[model samples]
Structure formats: C-alpha cells, structure tokens
Target chain A: MNEREVIETLKMIQEEKLDIRTITMGISLRDCADESAKKSCGRIRDKIRRVAGRLAAVGDEIEESYGVPIINRRIAVTPISLVAESSRTDDYLPFALALEDAARDADVNFIGGFSALVHKGMTGGDRKLIDSIPRALAGTDRVCASVNVATTRAGINMDAVSLMGKTIREIAEATKDRGSVGCARLVVFANAPEDNPFMAGAFHGVGEAEAVINVGISGPGVIKSALEKIRGSDLETVAETIKRTSFKITRVGQLVAREAARRLGVPFGIVDVSLAPTPAVGDSVAFILEEMGLESCGAPGSTAALMLLNDAVKKGGLMASSFVGGLSGAFIPVSEDLGMIEAASRGSLSIEKLEAMTAVCSVGLDMIAIPGDTTADTIAAIIADEAAIGVANNKTTAVRVIPVVGRKAGDVVEFGGLLGRAPVIPVSRFASSDFIGRGGRIPAPLQSYRN
Target chain B: MKAIITVVGKDKVGIIAAVSAELAGCGVNILDISQTIMQDNFTMMMSVDLSGSSVSLKELKARLNGIGERMGLVINMYNEELFNSMHRV
Candidate 1:
C-alpha cells in the first residue's frame, strides 16, 4: 500500500473506536487441590497471585504500543469447586475469602471459576458448594460463580434445577436492598464451553493446557454503523453488510490476540467472535439482528433469525482469524441488549420463547427475572435443562438467571448501567427433585471422537 | 549482534519447537517470538541475539533455508537495524 493508504488505515482504526474487549489469562488450578481445604485454598491464592501478577502491566504496555485499548485484563481459573472439594464445614467460608483476596493481589477486575458441574445430580461436595454460593458471592467483591445443571446426553437434572431456583430467590431476598441484585454475578448453564473468556461464564475448561491466554472481541458499533449506512437496503444487503463488517472486526481481534500472546510469552488461545452486547444503546447484537427484519427481538421466527445471524458471523470471522473458538456466536443476554429489554417490556418477548432460542445461541436463559418465592429445586432443574442442551450439541452455553424478591411479572428491577435492568419473567411452579436426585456422570456422547 | 528471523509458508506440526531448538543449538538467545496462521499459511517472527554463533549470517541463513526446504517452509533474515525500522513505531 502507498503512504496515503497506510495513513488512512491508521486513522480509521483510531477514529472508529475499535478496541480489544478483553485479554484473559487462563490459569490451571489443578495443582492447588489438596486433601485439606485450608491448604488447598492457600495454594490456589498463591498460584493466582504469582501467575497473574504482571498481567495488567503487560496488557497496558501492549495496549499503548498497539494504539488499541485493551478494555479489560482478567483471569479464568480452574473451577473452584474442584479445588474446594476438600473443604470442611468450617473451611468453606475462608476458602471463598481466599479467592477474593487472590483477585485483589492480582489486581484483576474479576476472577471467574467459582463453579460446579451438576448436570445429572449433585455430589455431596457439589451440594455443599451450591449451598455456599450466596455466602461466597455476598462475601466476595470480584469472585464470579456459575453452575451447570443440564446437558443433552443426560437430560436436565430437575433436582439441581429446583435447588438453584430457590437459591436465587434467597440471594435476592438477602440482598433486596441492593436492588435484589446479588444474582448479577451468578450464571447457570447447559452446554458450557471449556474456554469462554467472558463472565459470569468463564472457567478454565478441563480441556485447557496448564496456562494460556484467550481473547474475546466485540464490535456491535461497527456492525450497527454498517447497517446504518445502508438504511432502507434489502435484507440481502443488510446481511452482506453485517458479514463484511464482521470480517473487519475479526481481523482486528486476530491482530490483538497475536500481539498479546507474543508480548505475554504465552500460547495464543481462541478468539471468541461473539457480538457481546452491553447496556449502552446502539450496541446490542440483538438490535442488529432486529434490523435484519424482526419486528421484535423475540417473536415467531426469532430462533431462525438468530441462527442465520450466528452462522453468518462465524462464516465471516472464520475467514479473518484462523484461531476462532470460545462460543463464537451472538449472545442474547436480555437485559444487556436494549432492544431485547424494550421488546420484553412491551410483552413481545417471554421466558418460554427465550428458552427455545437458547437452542441456537451461546447462552441459555441469561439475565432473566423470576419471582422471589421460586423454589431452589426449580432453579436447579432449569440449570440441568440448559446443561443438557450444551452437552447434547457439544456447544458452549450459560444461564444468568435473576430472581427479583418482591417483584412479580410486569415489575422491573433496575441493576443500572451495563448490568442493565430486567422485568420479572414468570417461571414454572413445579419442582424436579426426583430426576435430579439420580446422581451420576452423564456418559460421554456416542459421537465423542477426536480422530 | 541482534537479528530477526522470519518464517513463512505452510504450517505443520513441530514448526515452532524445531526452529527454536535450532537457534538454541547456536547458543542464540531468543528475546521474543510471534506466530500466526492465516488460512493454510504460516508466518512467524523471532528476535534473537546472534553473538557467539560459529556460523556467519549467510551460512546461518543457508542452514535455516535448508531446514525450511526440508519441511516445505520459507526462511529469511534481516539485520537488527532493518528489523527495528520495520517494526518500531
């Protein structure tokens, strides 16, 4: 390219506000597990601190060098449930506290992986961990938690799902003065991916190497701008515009991941090309999907609409980056997407339809609001069902469910800012403990094969 | 002296470990390495200290080129000055 072309390209990146969304360091905490919970917790804290100490500093240096903003520097560790398995009754609280301290020492905004796998049924340890979620989240400022309760292979664990529903309700009541917002940091899942870098969903997948770095990029503005330029254009043109826009966005992500991996001296992990939406207006992935001609975010043909959007995004992103992974699709987190919120407010969307849409996207039942009196076992069943979807399809999935205390359907609970607000969506009153009580690992699927 | 090593062409297993091992044999201290795969094409950059090498620049390039030929790779080398001018903003 000529000098003028080079100058113009630089200006485009600078002026367009294109920035790297996150640089997440994945730490393996398998080494932290010990027979005693206190010893295990201590090792986990030390491991996180030592391995992640220079993460923010290194990320900032690269951000300055590249002239791109690396918006967040974070860490995802091996699920704490695995590490905290040895906790005695007296040890669980301190173990959670140790995790909080680790995040502070590492200077990371959030430390994910306070999670458990209970798709089929809860083990004794899993039950204890599930029960401790409210205390763990309330006591810790930056530690995030998730639980998987469903998968296709084993079906949803109604028992665990029921438990989570009640747990969410309790946490909401416990933190009602804080807008009943304690569930903001918790996620439930079906088909949870092993290498997600985003949170309330990220955990060091069991398949990950000892340590690595994964990156997720967002470009809702880029896609929206592309759509805006071609106003009144036909659906094909809109789809084509989104495709081309996603291509450019993914190229930037590829460059950022390569440079970050080089600077950090770690292996380059996947680039999740998910069009993650925030609370801000004009940046919702669902809005872009809606612009492609859905009257509302969730309506008849919504799942098909979502499938097309998700497929086109992967097609464009795959062309731009060879290392694409980590739930590379559109996220339909209701509250975070302004268009979805508006649709829900107007009664164009509902909880049942959202569950149906989860069959195609990266998450299930995310940022949903239910009543305060919902039973714990019902929530557990929901998680179990979502896990079944993920396990069945061999795809990553998650749930960010919120139960608003004292808020019924049609009532809105505001979380403010990027966390957004949600209208209480009704849930089924029935419980599912009998199936959930059948405890065992769902056998690996028939199609599980690397060769 | 500092030097830059560039590798390009098709990607295959063991590319990174093999090249780094060859550099290690020369006692070359590697400062950094960046690698990416675009489609079937592989590209890499390695900054290394060339001091104390028994081989001359031409010979080192020839040896690296030979390794590349054996593995269907392309190899190139640049002086420290040129490398810095190209990369340093």
Candidate 2:
C-alpha cells in the first residue's frame, strides 16, 4: 500500500465511479420441494429468509468499512420450476409470491429464479411455470423471471422462444398501467450462466452448493476515464489500457466477495467481472466505446471496438480472480446507459445495430424500449437472433426488452431509478409470425458437435 | 491495522495541526505524512497505525470526517488492505 497506489485507488473511487454493483447470495431451494404448493412456498420462503438474512447488513458493513459503495444486496434462488415441480397445483403464482415475501423479509432488492429451463424441451412443470410468468411478474414486485430457451449443448427451443415472446407481451399488457415495467423484470436467455449475479437474468443452477455468495463489479466510468487518458493511442494500446483498468476493478470485487461470503458463512461463488453501466453521466459502457474513437455508439466499427473491449476485460479479470464465471464482459443496456439512450433518441443508434453489437458483447439487446405496437413474433425473432449469436459463439446472452404499451416510436418511457428511462426505438415493421409460428427446436449448430 | 487518511481542500491555517491533534487524541499513531499545495488548494495524505488506537476504525473515520467538515475540507479514510489487494498482484 504505497502512497501512489492509495491515491490512484481513491481517484478511481471518487472520480472514476468504481463500485461493487451487487452482492448476490445464491440459495438453492431444491430441498424445499413439497407435493403441496402451500407447504412448498412456506419452505421456500423460510429457506431464503434464513440463508440471506444478514446479506443486506453485511453488505452495508463492508461498504462502510472499506469505503466502497455496494449498490445492491440481492438473492438468487434455484429455478422455481424445478423446486415446485412436485407440487400438484398448476399455478406458480404462489411461488413467485413466496419469493417476494422472502425478499421483503430478507430486505434485499431483487430475488431471481422464478424461472424455467426449457432449452431442449419443456416439462409439465416448466410449461406451467412459463404460462404463469405474465401473472407472476405482474403480481410480484421483487420477483424476477427468466427462461433459458437456448444452450450451446441443447440448441434453441423455438417453442419456448415463441412462448416467451407471447409471455412478454402478456406481461406488458398485464402491467401496462406501470408503463409495462413488469417486462423489464423478465429476461429470456440463451446459454444462461448458473452463478450470474446480475438480473433479471441471475438464477441458482442445480449444480451449485446449497448457498453461495457471488459479486458483480461495476466501473464503466473507471474504464472510460482510463481510456480518456490514452486518447489517440493505437488499438492495441487501447486494449491494454482497458485490461489494466479491469484488473484493478475486479480485484476490488474479489475482495468484497470474499469478505461478504466469510461474514455470511456461505461459500464464495464466482465474481462476475462485468462493466455494468448506470444512466448517470460518465458511468456508461457506450461512453467507453465512443472514447475509443467511434463518432457515436452504434456507429460503424462499434462491434469491433466492443469485441476488443470485452475480450480485454475478460483477459485482465481472469488474472485478478481465481474463479471467474457469470457474464464476464461488457453490458450494453440502452436505458441504463446515458450515451446509448442519447444515441438511440437521435437515431445514431438503432435496434438493428444493437443486435449486431450483442454478437460481440456480453448481453443481448437489453433495457431497450420498443414501440407499443411491436408484435410478440417480432420480439421472439429478436430473441432468436440473439440466441443464435450466443449459441454460435458459445457464450451467454439475454434479452430484456420492454415494449412500452401505448407508446409509439419517438416516445419515451420513464422507469426511473436504476432501471432508468428509455426512448421508444422502432422495431422492424416486417413481420416474423410465420417464422416464429413454425415452432420446433433449432437443432444444435456444428460448433456444438465438438463433444 | 493501517489506514490511509487523505484530506483535500482550499489551503488554510492549522489544517495539519487540527488533523494531527484529532488523531493523537484517539491514540492513533501517524507513521508517515505528506502535504502539498497546488493552485491554492491544500492536499494532505497520512499513513496511520490504528491497531494501537482505542477507538474503532469507524469511530475514527467519523471523528476525522467531523473535523474535516468543520474545517471546510473533504476527508477520506480507507483501510490499507483495499490498496494492497488492488495494486499488489
């Protein structure tokens, strides 16, 4: 701890906006299953409440003692579909309600895992859970829902993809009074990670320990500021600079994750080395891309720039932590990033370009607001396209588009707080109903044949 | 445990005196101190040993922040582990 290092760290915190984005305790609920939904929900709630009781207080203590801001304290439970499968009742709304109750009791921000994994095909419980998503998300405030519709190994489940498209539309319609904010809490995934700490995509997988603590690091501002100092440098130098910055940022996350896990007496899960952005000025992933010499985000060469940035971040972060999992790359959620929002509003960025960018970055078209008239088929097509990228590349990608009800293109949807606001970006008018209607498994690609 | 205390604000009289007095009152030993003035703003950084201090680290931080507020300065206290973990491998 030399003087220069101390000053540099302080600067990163004060000026560069480095902070731990979340400390998510992943609690497995497999043992809580029961034949009766009532008893099952009761056991689920008790398990979450007991496991994550000290999460928020511990997060606060760490933040205060270390002088690093921990933005969120959340919990991720095992996919409810698996846990509630033994229950006879078809409705899974009670499961979502129980999750919300436990989240409230534990005093966490969001609780994930109201989810079903039907990448290959759907089970009876998975179908019921998928059917109840719209109602579940609409009714519960803290519960987030996700469905893994594609995987590199299992291929894409077109039936489930189509179902999710319709589910999202139903969710939007059910919560239209709140500007369809419920849809924001639902994520459709391809190759979803088991230990992700970010939401609405995080869920505890079956293979994980009974309980674990995972951390997500955020510092788009720090990386952007670091690149700002190396302006006019070559592409290689730019990548190197980003790598160094990510290394420093991820080390802090590793520290916090270890300390939190120790205090909570939970096994430490992987550190998600993602540069998650906020709507605040200077705290944006798009700004990092633009600082790399793009005229604006979504411009030509934006994907190339993002690819370099993402690869470098992972390269640097891998050395900082021994166990790095989750979506360890850059996130380009439009509404959560001021630069992307400005670009979208001005037409400098479009949904098409965003789709292309997702081919290279971590997540797919995220936090984007589409026109109210956008059809379920089109959203499903969008998800399919992003899934193709993830499946082909063997990486994780997710879609969390909110189609603001009654708002057409050129309108703005205000979802204030960390969710931020989004300008309604127009979707393709050309229909994809015929393609989505032809629902069957898009068989695993050639790349998936390596085994 | 070691902690670094940094103070930054417009240059003024008795800034060091008041800060050191507060630390000494809490039985915190200052191992190293550095001060600089750039463009009429004063900046000070100190390496202090808190293991011998009677007050908890949180209390010392709060006390130092209070002193900083009264002196129209900004003070930050961070555990040295934060720097070591970030900078050293």
Candidate 3:
C-alpha cells in the first residue's frame, strides 16, 4: 500500500473506535409445537437453551481476539403463539416464563419473539396469546412481547388493533406503580418483519434457517461528528457524505459480526444499521439534527433531517452488507438522546413532534420519560397515536418509554450506560382518562381496508 | 474493463490519496469515489475504468492486494456486472 493511504486508514481506525452492537441468534421454534401448552413450552425452552448455550461465550472470545466490542448477545426465537395452538386455556404466561428462564440460562440481557404475527387474521393461538400479554409481561422480568396488527400486503387487522389497545391498558393496570412498566416490554407493529433484531420487536422470520447470528449497529455520535465537518457544504454533498459515513460504520459492524459468527460456527444473519443514539452529550440523533443546522431536535426541519438520515443510512449500509434488516434507520428516542432531552426540557420538542419524526425513523417516542402520574389511558392514547403512524406508513415502529416513578417535570433520572438518562418531560396536564378509559378500541386506520 | 474497487480496513489517513494516486499513475479514469471515516475504521468505494491501462485485472488485483497487506487493509475488486448485481437490491 502507498504510505499516504496507509496513514489515512490508520488515523481513522485510531479515532473512530467502531464496534459491533449485538450478536442476536435467531432460532425458529416452529418444530416445538404440541397440543399441550406445558409440553410445548418445555420443548421450546429446551431448544433455545441447548442451541444458544455457547452463543455468548463464542461471541466474547471473538470480540477479544478481533478487538471489536460485541456489546449485546441475544436470541430471537420463533413467535411463541405459533407453538401455543394447543393451549385451550391460554397458557402464554408459562411460555413467557420459560423463555425468560432460557434467556437467564444463556446469560443474555434480552430475548425477543414473545410475539404474535396477526396482521391479517388472528388464529386461535394468536388470540389467546394476545389476551395473555399483560400477564406474561407482569409475571416475568425480561420477557418482551410484540404484536403485528397491520401490514402492507394484507392490510391492517382491526380486531388485533382493538385487542392490543386493551392489552396495553391491562399492562399498565398490572404495573401501575411503574407507570405501566410492563407496557415497556410490549410493542405494536405495522408491516412487522420477521428478521428484526431489536428489542420488544425482534423475531425469527419464517424464511430463515434453523439459526443464524445477526448484529444491530448504532452510533449516532459518529454521524453527527461527520456532519459537523461539512457545515457549509451544499445539501447534496451533505447527503452524500452521510451515506458514505454510514457505509463505513456499517462495514465495521458487518466485519465484526461476520468474524464473531464465524468464530462461533454459525451462519451470519444480518446487520441492523440502526443509528441508535444514547443520552450522552455528543452521541445523539438529535445532535445530528442540530449539527445539520436545526436549532433543536423538534424544530421545523426535524422531519426533513430524519428523512435524509434514514435514506442515507440505508443506501450506505446496503452497500456494506447484503444481510441487512431490522429497522435500519436513525432512532429518535427523546429520553435516550441527550439533545432530544434538552430539547424536550426547553419545550422545543413535544410528543406531537416526536410522533412526526417516527414517520421517517424506526422507533417511535423511544425512552420518553413522562410525568409519574400520567394516567394509563393517556399512555394508551400515546400508543394509539404512534400505532396510527405505523399503520398508515406501513413501517415497523415501537415505543419503549419509561415513566420514571415519582419523577415530575424537570426531574432527571440516570439509567446509566446504554439505557442512558433523561429529564422528565411534562405531558399535557389534562388527563386523557376519559378517552383512554373508554374500553372500546380505536377503529383500524383507513389503509387497512384491503380485502 | 471497468470495475469498482472497495478497500475496507482500519481507518487511517492517506488511504484515499494513495489509492487515487495509484489510479492516476496507471492512466485510469476514476468515475466516482465515496469514503467514510468512522471511529477506528475507514471504508471506501471507488469506481474506475482501465480501458487504456497497461495492467490486466489480475495484475491490478495483485498490486492492490500487496498495497492492502502492507497497510493492513482488505481489498476486493469486482467487475461492473458483479458490482451492480451486488447492490441491485
């Protein structure tokens, strides 16, 4: 190599500190189906435990040798409801418990696929599992659940949508002290995909093999730093640069994940090129918007910034790896992103603005810390709002908000590390309990009318 | 033949300048180049045509490989068809 080129590559490597985000093993539990819920749950748990026993250690060893940090080691099993067809009495809680046990045994932080793919028509098992979501989440600590109520192909499922609204309310009521802490583990999706590796939404698609290792990479700070360099550059140049930067970041993730999967003797799954931002000062999607010339994250140009970032991230990441899936775009979590928190605290960003941003990005109203006394009905209203966006747009969107207990406006809670910290932003003082308390579900979006 | 050459490795300075200089020396026309500098990593994709160049694809690949080895880089070369197909999706 030429001396000049060698030096340039070395400098980038030295300064960038790129690493892999998560090595998620997607395992299909389709074969674990049985007429008996207990037997099926036992088999499903055993299969996961046996197959993923060595996943974490292998990933760690590869990380040590390759000098790439594999931050999270997780598993995404088949949708639990698909195997609960035989449970006439609704035994989804036990299944969830079993999956949580498996996650503990595997020593992983989270395991996805406690889900139901009922975007078209609800099977008996799907209906049963949906009814049990509140119990499943409240009874278990680490179990996450997702329900796909709409899709571009089959249209939206109003029955499922209405059910989820009630399910969310039940989840809140079950964990009222934590402001619907159980709801934090649930996601309602539209156009939901099978290969997403992110939490509360990840699942093994039907087309996947027995098992494979996928990675989700995130670094909003990296993109924000690059944008800072080309402050005066033209819009087109800015777009091109964002794409190029995303390519490089995604390449690092691809390489690290490929090496990790290879070391573990598993097939490489995907690289979720999501720009997951943290609440750290410089590492935020909101920061990227500000660097792009926005006064605040929810300013007038927020949606445009999100659109450009999402497109560029996909264009660049697609070129870096073929196995790319999940919500491969910028994340706009208010509480998790330092800049967004500041914006919210300053009254610049609002729930309405954040929902608008979700039309472009993946996660909706993420890590948002609301007032401790926010009513369950209000939280349901928020979920319905985000779900409407997802349904209309035919995209996968999730809400992972924390209603900090006893925390009022201006109060800040420190989650520390990747979960980050956020200031408790005030919601509307008026209670939406009357609207949310109405037990009936909102009708499906107009887009869901396809036969 | 026209081809797209992708060089991926630890991010270091001068990789682009050196790669571009090499293409210029060979009388090759560089159509477009995109580069991103990430934390501790550098990735680049360059499109070049060698219709009038003296070196064959094999020789060009060998030279690039040598350069990559010396710089701790991984170099991959693909013809137009392969390049377009890999990114069609």
Highest-scoring model, lDDT: 2
CAPRI band of model 3?
incorrect
> In candidate 1, what are the lDDT values of residues A141-189, reduced to their tens digit?
7788888776666666656666776667777777777766778888877
What candidate 2 gets wrong by more than 4 Å, as runs, is A448-451, B11-13
Q: Write the per-residue lDDT of candidate 2 for residues A304-369, one digit (tens) a residue.
A: 999999999999999999789989899999999999999898898999899899988898989999
Q: Compute each candidate's TM-score over C-alphas.
A: 0.76, 0.97, 0.76
Clashing pairs in 2: none
DockQ of 2: 0.78
TM-score for model 3?
A: 0.76
Candidate 1: regions farther than 4 A off: A2-17, A87-91, A232-236, A428-451, B1-89
Question: How many pairs of residues in model 1 come into backbone collision?
Answer: 32
TM-score of the second chain, cand. 3 = 0.86
Q: Write the per-residue lDDT of candidate 3 for residues A86-160, one digit (tens) a residue.
A: 665666788988999999999988888888988778888898888888888888877888888666566656556
Chain A TM-score for each of the predictions? 0.88, 0.98, 0.88
CAPRI band for model 2: medium
True lDDT of residue A374, candidate 3: 67
Could you give the DockQ of candidate 3? Answer: 0.03
